[model samples]
Target: MNKQHGSHEDKAERYELKQTLSTLQLWGIAVGLVISGEYFGWSYGWAAAGTLGFVITSLFVAAMYTTFIFSFTELTTSIPHAGGPFAYARRAFGPTGGYIAGAATLVEFVFAPPAIALAIGAYLNVQFPSLDPKHAALGAYLLFMGLNIIGVAIAATFELVVTVIAIFELMVFMGVVAPGFSIANFTKGGWSGQDVFSLGAIPGIFAAIPFAIWFFLAIEGVAMAAEEAKDPKRSIPIAYVTGILTLLVLAIGVMVFAGGSGDWTTLANINDPLPKAMKFIVGDNSGWLHMLVWLGLFGLIASFHGIILGYSRQIFALARSGYLPHYFAKVHPRFKTPHRAILAGGVIGIAAIFSDEMIKIGGQTLTANIVTMAVFGAILMYIVSMLALFKLRRAEPGMERSFQAPFYPYFPAFALFGALVCMGTMIYFNPLIAAIFAGVLMLGYVYFRLTRSQRETPPQNEVFEPSEELA
Candidate 1:
């Protein structure tokens, strides 16, 4: 009887992830993984759809993300798996759906880090004239990946500390830039060569959608740390809610301050938007400018390190569940970390950073294009995960749940509707890249179908129950 009731403990032990993360640490992971976006990537939206247009696009993305995060909290708390969206979709839709969710997650988590790594490189180059951006990026990948492989506790602690500093630096940045923030500067290019209601403006906002989404992109990655969290049922919800709120405020403040400090056009596509904006406000060689450039690296490093942690756990979960080769799932005996997964993700990210530099489409650099591709992956997972949530409500009505998504069908429906609009807009503006993303998903599905023999069949009726856990 006691063993039956202690299944949670058994599951925890067997899952292989060390549970050392508190709500604060989880919040750190959540915020740190996404802080870099407020520092960069998002400004590219201005290039696509001027200042006001991008701001409008961001409003839509913000709504989608807010609703999505709330609904997603239910899944994270109820399921509590490192696989995150993959685990939820797997339980709701079985192995095939699981693979699709996992693939989307893999794409989102894997591709995001390289984009941040590139930004890290850009920030370093601003501070160190001798450093090449690519070399700086490669060096960042090497250092952070090693740190992640060493241990999760140390990694999470580092994430918390850096995230706090990054948050503070952003506050300081806003204070310094506030005096230069003219409404005239912010509205200078509100529509960028197209009338507000023109068909051309439609595609402009569509093109800006990815960058808008960048503001809060990987905050959902908090759920990926669920398995490593202490008291996940309680901690996940707190972290998710707090993380989204933090990102929301930071996103609005950063965008408004940066755009108002200078011509939005000039700052639009740069990887170091904050430093550039600071230079506009405080002169090119001012101490404030230099300070921001250095502190800005912490924002990049926070996301770089946090996302590396997310992708490794994602890879580990997929491999352990037989979705990939078993070798990648092996946790380090001493550190209890997913060393193989971390290194594998690092190798892939480094290659992506190099490859993206060589590829360009319609005048957009590899970084911009890859950012779109990653958002495509995230939107796909969002759509699927929302559907999974609805399905599980019906399929597993009797299942225990620590958190239930408020506004139920309405909240999720709104999120789904927003995601679909975003996806359609993405496909409209970048059909070829969208097609390629679809092709990748199709290939993933086919591969999983053919390799069904390799995957171990999980228990039939208890798919949502954490296997090998205490009751």
Candidate 2:
């Protein structure tokens, strides 16, 4: 029995997949990343606000991300493994800074799910007034969180359904809007949002860039599903390229298409703009078409599913690394999912329900402070990773590369340039809010350095063999 126990442990190790995913899964995972939970609103908000100029501005911003994705694809194809930016930073910065880079990302992954879950609750409340939106959000967050705990395959399958709904809705939208698109509407207010784009326009733009650039924020999926990709090298590159391009086309297309069809004043104010646009194009004949508008509804569900998967993996990685409790790293015996991490994400989300504050900002709507916090964290991680990528290129010039970032210094240079722009924009738009987020990251960084223990994350090469033979 003792021998059997040891054997079982070793077998678990065999299946541990410290590094296991394939390329196909990686690509699907990449696609899954961009169709993030918060996007349904993000894009709609960008469109309807009629900042037609701003929407176009946003499309330009979205286009700018191509450079970053290509650069990442180049890296993913070459490096093509998990730990993502954390993996990259670790290699470039060594233990100290690497750990720091990854820790910063933890802030992003950790906060994303709750932000999204909360958003779901808000939308539900909007649809059905009496539902205690917060309660609906709580229940919804818990249900999907449970789905994520099942395993990535299940999550991916569920998420694929959501992505399909979202994309189909968008595609239908494009088809409907294209014929109705009047170039006159687009050019009429081509320069309308001029007020918001003043002397502070550049700064404001930079601050907003973080919010817009990677509307998908799918980079987390690279690391989370790294272990499951079929051919991470070839598959990831294709998926990375396809996913980014697809989103870029679909995302930019819809809003730009919508802006051409109508003005910001008209489009922006409607509750569900995309669906509303469909209604405008198809009319009541679209009661069936309205069903398609429910794509955002399906999207909300999918976004919930995907974020849970990404966050759970981050938790699993953290737990395995010693940054979090060990139990969180546990893989389900049969499911092979990070059951503990799933639970942690769920509990935190549930706990957040208690703190849901309805703040009146963009015209009397209830938004979670936690959502903004998540954005701050994601930006911080990217900043550190940018520096890491820069240093790595210089410090370890000889590191093998199957896929070097195109245009050499220029390609990643573009990403670094663009990333900075976006970060600056996010901050400019929300001064007090951005400051609080920065403070939290600073606090987390300090806490980690102060608490060095056996709990410290061990490297991939380290053995878990402590007293194993003795036992």
Candidate 3:
């Protein structure tokens, strides 16, 4: 009897994640998961809609993310599950909704890192012209996956350090370029490359939605780490509220500074825009330009490393819930990290990095298409999450909520509306990627439906039960 009981305890331990993240660490994960947007990907918006037009798209996106974060915090605190949106949707709408949410979140987290990793390689290439960007990107995946597997606390600490440095670097970038910034330069040909806005620019603005969303795309991934937070209910709200505000300021500051520094056209399609923008201001040989090249890497690293952490948790949670193969659910015995999940995500990201040269769609680079696909996943998850929030409010009225979304129905309603608009525009502009995204989700659903009987219930300790009020 004693030996049987010990085996059962060991089985339960295999699925548990350690709780060690504090408020500051949680804030770091929130910002770190997205800081790379200010560095590279958002510049593509300039190519799609020009400066002023993209700005309009950005503001709309910022509004959606702000409202979404405010509303999302309530669910994070109430459920506090590693599955994040998946857990909430499962409780509110059952297995199908949970599968959709989990699959979408997985796509968002998994696809995001490769884009950031490529940007990291681009930054390194600026310094070492002989090195292949793809090789550097692959190396990054290996390095960070090791760090994450070592332990969550160690990973979170590293994320916090890099995130702070990245933020400071952006402030430095704005200050260095301030003297060269010109409002006339920024607004020149600011509407779909035309000098003035016209009815024609409407399509460009809509097309810019994905790049605009890139500016704040993965900020919501913080919810994945809620299960590992030391004080999730109180700490998550503070971290999320403050983190969104921080990214908003950084995104705008970085964009304005880069656009106004030189010919905005030159920065539009490149992965190393900040360094190139700095070159225009300081000249290529200046130490300041060199410094930007080296330090700009941290912004990309912060996001790449942070998103790897996010994707692994999502995979682990899905596996734990039997939505994915149980092979991925095992936590490392000593480190208590999801080793298989981290390695699994890294393999996917590395494959993407390798395929960069072989793939191009709609004349956009692999990085751009990857960014758009990630946004598709993110927007879909956002729409489903908001719907779950509404359903849960009615279905479990007395469910304990340490933090309530301010303005309730209005805030979430607007978030839902904005997400739907973004989704519609993205599909209109990027039909091929949209189709691919849909296909991935459908395949996942089929697997989920066929395997319903084989699904394993998580251990009792891993399950989240509502308070007595829910009874």
TM of each candidate vs. truth: 0.94, 0.83, 0.97
lDDT of 1 by residue, 106-202 (tens): 9898999889988988888887879999899899999999999889999999999999999999999999999989999988768876788666666
Q: How would you encode candidate 2's per-residue C-alpha lDDT over 143-222 as one tens digit per residue?
A: 88778766666667666666776677667668876887877766564444445456433333343444454365655466
Query: At residue 157, what lDDT does model 3 achieve?
Result: 95
Q: What TM-score does candidate 2 reach?
A: 0.83
Alpha-carbon deviation at 34 in model 2, angstroms: 2.1
> What lDDT does candidate 1 reach at residue 187?
86
Clashes of each: 7, 24, 0
Error of 3 at 152 (Å): 0.7
For residues 1-471, write the lDDT of model 3, one tens digit per residue: 999999988887899888999999999999999999999999999998999999999999999999999999999999998889988888887778888899999999999999999999999999999999989998999899999999999999999999999998898899999999999989998896564434778888899999999999989899999989999999999999999999999999999999999999999999999988888788989988888888888889999999998999999998887788888999998999999999999888888878856768899999999999899999999999999999999988999999998999999999999999999999999999999999999998889877765464443225544331111
Q: Which regions in candidate 1 have their CA more than 4 angstroms from the true location?
A: 1-15, 197-200, 457-471
Candidate 2 lDDT (Cα, whole model)?
A: 0.59
**Ranking under TM-score, best-scoring first?**
3, 1, 2
Candidate 1 or 3, higher TM-score?
3
